[model samples]
Target chain A: GAGVSQSPRYKVAKRGQDVALRCDPISGHVSLFWYQQALGQGPEFLTYFQNEAQLDKSGLPSDRFFAERPEGSVSTLKIQRTQQEDSAVYLCASSLNSYNEQFFGPGTRLTVL
Target chain B: AQSVSQHNHHVILSEAASLELGCNYSYGGTVNLFWYVQYPGQHLQLLLKYFSGDPLVKGIKGFEAEFIKSKFSFNLRKPSVQWSDTAEYFCAVVSGTYKYIFGTGTRLKVLA
Candidate 1:
């Protein structure tokens, strides 16, 4: 079975630009999560969705960060007005349910100049 | 303000050496603990988890973790590590919710 997957494995953007990272969770997964991992750091929670419903956005660092999962399977993390501080790996994970083990994707590395 | 702590940032050991990594969380209630490993160029994968029933749980590749509720610690250990085990290990904890709090992670380098 295919695990969680993220697109645009690598992206480079200038400051003030907007970037979107996409994630495709495994089929039948009901929970999705996004995290940010800085250099030499562990992943930090960004947001979480349960079957198209955004339950938690408190982990989002700033107002420029936004996420959505309209169809319940595909989710997107969009960062507006990118900043050098936003240069990190965006990781996506999904689970069969909220309490199940999460499967992580090969994160999309975003480099903001 | 739930947070996790990994005391060891980096570890180096020769093959067949015993390995132990420390992890602690700052949550008081019941919690779930997990250990994840990321090989070079690979995505993070679950190594083991401690949910209930047992304080000690075994995982893939001869890995295991012991959860001590009173101490607020879940430490990973391996009897004899292989060279292929060189990777970054992350310890995460979930308390009362699905959101996981991860530690800074420990990078392990095993020499053959």
Candidate 2:
């Protein structure tokens, strides 16, 4: 794909439900990132992947948040026992290298009701 | 603990007016700075980035930002603005570990 693609542009889940969001990064991009953006706020880093290795996840909010980039290309962010505070826009981005320009996806808006 | 701060939460200007957005980061270590723009109903896009070159960096859409190491600031400026420039702007900082920390963001609205 020319740009990063994210699935489920919008999602509404009940409290305590589990939800999964997917991301397809640019072809052969070595770096992938996941972020969460609350309403009226900037995106916050959640996790990072260098190829298939999850090198950094210090920003993950809690144990309920888990992200995986299995083959270094596509990634998934799963939230277990979602809370109302978990409602936010989940963004996925990819970069050619660890330190370079990052291409962002449209983002998935998750609303936990 | 490194963090980014955007002073302005919202800005409104008329077309053809000059614009400036303030961004400051709290980090003493070596870092990279970036400015990103998010247009209406669009994903975030990189406007410009400052790595290890001149203090002044120019980006697409006639945007430029000056990195002042002493002040720990990277402020975005445009000599003249257009209606198309209306968008939400974000300032980001990347530390040695590659975690990109972003500011609160500023929403710009340009009236024709």
Candidate 3:
């Protein structure tokens, strides 16, 4: 794709439900990132991946938040037992390399009810 | 830990007015600075970036920013702004290392 793309532009889940958001990065990009942005706040880093290897997950808020890029292209962020505090916009970005400029997707707005 | 600061939480100006948005970062080593804008309902887009070379960097849409080493600042400026320029602006910094940090963001509303 020309730019990063995310699926399920909007999602609503019950407090205890689990939700998965998908991201398709630019073709051949080697770096991918996930961020969560709360209302009126800047996007917070979640996790980072270099190709299929997960290198940085320090920013993940909790154990319930998981992300994976199995084939080095498409990625998924899964939240277990979603909570109201988890309601936010989930953004995905990809760069050709760790030092290169990143391209962002439209983002998935998740609402945990 | 590294962090970026944007003091202006919200700014409003009339069309054709000059614009200046402040950005600062706390880091001791080499850094890459960037400014991004997110229009209503749109994804974030790069406005300009300063990787190296001259401290002054020019970006798209007549936007430019200066990187001041002593001040630890990279302030975005434009001689004039259009209504379309109204958007949420963010300043970011990546230390010589790979990790990038972003400011809280400043919302600019250009009155047409």
TM-score of each: 0.98, 0.98, 0.98
Question: Can you write out model 1's per-residue Cα lDDT over A27-80, one digit (the tens) per residue?
Answer: 999999999999999999999999999999999999999999999989999999
Q: What is the TM-score of chain B alone in each candidate?
A: 0.99, 0.99, 0.97
Q: What lDDT score goes with residue A14 in model 2? A: 98
Q: What would the DockQ be for model 1?
A: 0.90
Candidate 3: residue A53 lDDT (0-100): 97
lDDT of 2 by residue, A22-112 (tens): 9999998999999999999899999999999999898899999999988778899999999999999999999998887889999999999
Which of the two, 2 or 3, has more lDDT? 2
Q: Rank the candidates by TM-score, best first.
A: 1, 3, 2
Which candidate has the highest lDDT of all?
Answer: 1
Lowest summed lDDT window (length 10), candidate 3 chain B:
B94-103
Tens-digit lDDT track of model 2 for B11-76:
999999999999999999899999999999999999999989799999999999999999999999
The C-alpha RMSD in Å for every predicted model, in order, reads: 0.8, 0.8, 0.8
**Which residue pairs show backbone clashes in model 3?**
none
Interface RMSD measured for model 2? 0.8
